[model samples]
Target: MANNFGRVVEVMVSNMLFSMDKYAIEGTIPFDNDLLPNESEIKLWNLSKDTISRIKRNETLMINAGYRGDVGVILHGFVSSVLTKREGVDAVTSIHVLDSQDLSKRKVKDITYAEGTLASYILKQMVGQLGLPIAQFELNQDYRYEEGYTASGEVTDIIGKVAKDCGTSAYINKGKVYIRNLRRGADDVFALSKGTGLIGSSEPFEEEKFKGYRIKSQLQYRITTASVVDLKCKDFEGRVHVRSGTHTFSRTGDFMTDVEAILP
Candidate 1:
């Protein structure tokens, strides 16, 4: 009376999602960086001598990019946001360039198919952990499919939680993305970095660490249906001749509910 066909699909799809997300975070964090495979591209912000002395006495600071004059500079962190606000200028901006030799290129699905498939896999996993029956069937089969939508949308929404705790930009597009030791929802878009799928609002969170940043799970699950029924039958005492086979109980209505007893 046990059917594991559903479980087989569940495990396969869930494993796919989990591994893909894990790789997304791992791969992106170092892709834009020049470090080796085993290296980590993360660090806490170190303020300038002037900035530090000022913050010690004052509660805020202002920063401007053009103030560096003729040369470009890279500044990262929350302190930068506070400075941007104080400077009274736009804190973010972006411009997409065409590296494509063919401008006719376009997209109906994700520009990154693997990650999109990956997003679907992650979504399948999150809903599975929701402990809701019909969740998989509902989300996978019942939902409408809109190109450039849904699967990637859901994965981005949930991954946002982990990214928020990780204090990094958790985004996906094309084949590359980046992660850094960012402030809770800070983005590097203003630095000409394009970002999508940021971590969003959710329930209360806790402080824990994985790798280094504080971490918390946005997923939970439980069995939605489970039961056992007792079945009984009288023992048959007579043995029939092997050459003469006899009809047993009629096939119709002969089935019994499987019994599973848990003893103390």
Candidate 2:
């Protein structure tokens, strides 16, 4: 097991890099498959006047954070808002970002697909309209519209509809669109245990028909929505499908990834 001791963070805004090792930074980034864009709140402390002036709305923001050796990209999005204030003689800049902001809010032109058109093809077209790349587009079943289909309104909504028709779910992760089966997870599986950074015991919970556990571990970038994980704790031991999660880092000694997973 790699040492999860030293916290490392790097922030980039519009291609300008700011190392957290030099500047204190803290934030919470949440990821899920709720058919809505994921958002992040990043707080940077005591930056120079020129640095603060350069940050503007709609600029690209990418944050890479983890332990020294395990550091990876955790949040990639566009800045939606920037707020600065003075707290106890320190200047704090809070940057709020939205993943795939352009793609989520873009309204697709009304276009009717021909009869017998595959849902996957239409989904690709919608994503192409927003100019966002596809991370994964595997569907459990592809639906074919017999009477032709009309696509209108926001592209995110249309994608969600297409995913539902095809028996799956769609969501944006780190600026890429992913339409995947809920029952099956991604190919990469992370093993979590006491030696592998699993914190405490897994808490079991039942939500409607789903039975799963809420797990917390040292900040893991691999554990995202639709990712698979093999968890071994005193309370539970098995592989579960990650449904949703959050990767959080704070300078005041909090760095962890919390995820909700269900048995597959």
Candidate 3:
């Protein structure tokens, strides 16, 4: 009803923000650690001669996006690939990005903890060894790492093992690592209404497939994985934590956030 879909997508390269309004077609940035790699894709309608020369593989990129004047960073990574295609009168360019964790997957490391090592300490040490950027971190009570847990593996794998032992969920968002209890009703940000932000009917949860409601909302709220949000519809009413979410924008000034939230 209201004109609540305006957005701005900014792309930074070589420490400068390029003029993207003219090139941005549509882009998707997914914040997920389980199903898909935390990555982003920007489809460009037209690529200028100078812009083409400035972009190169392995360069660091920072993608910032905002909706209705509320702006926050959504992604950080390095350029993985770029391709171009011709469509009649217009040329299209596509850019792929890989998150920091993707960079860490290149090497293997050994993990050895003496008897009775704290889980939080182990996590901190592992992250430091991997040289990953952390924007936020949380851990509840202390849990000891028992003896004979020595191993050598990818850093992400070790972190997941530690989270399981501590009875917490570990995830990375916008380059930050989180190890905390599962989110529930008390963590819900606000209620959803039909015209306000909810897009369509809520899909019932199916445990067999690990599926939840498919929701499309305005980039009006700060939604991320493991954060609880409330949804009320004719067939459903409850709070669910986001399992995965994607924020996307197009040059035509359209902005949307899609989420798959699950009941805790």
TM-score of 1: 0.15
Higher-lDDT candidate of 2 and 3: 2
Tens digit per residue, CA lDDT, model 2, 98-178: 986756468867799999999989999988877878888898999999999999998788989999999898888898878
Record all residue pairs in model 3 with backbone atoms less than 3 Å apart, i.e. clashing: none
Please provide, for model 3 over 1-264, each residue's C-alpha lDDT reduced to its tens digit, 9 standing for 90 to 100.
Answer: 424556667788766574455455578888754412577887777777677667788788787776546666777777888888888988887888876546446345555678878888887777676575654456556678666356467777787787677766676665566666655323547566575567667777577736567777766436767767788776788877788778877766547778888776
Report the candidate with higher TM-score, 1 versus 3. Answer: 3
Count of backbone collisions within predicted model 2: 0
By lDDT: ranked, best first? 2, 3, 1
**lDDT of candidate 1 over 92-165, digit per residue (tens):** 11111111111122112232324224333443454343222221111112222233233233333453443343
- After superposition, the stretches of candidate 1 with alpha carbons farther than 4 Å from their true spots are 1-71, 75-116, 120-207, 210-264
Alpha-carbon local distance difference test for all models: 0.19, 0.86, 0.69
Q: Pick the candidate with the highest lDDT.
A: 2
Instruction: TM-score each candidate.
Output: 0.15, 0.94, 0.83
- Best-to-worst order by TM-score is 2, 3, 1
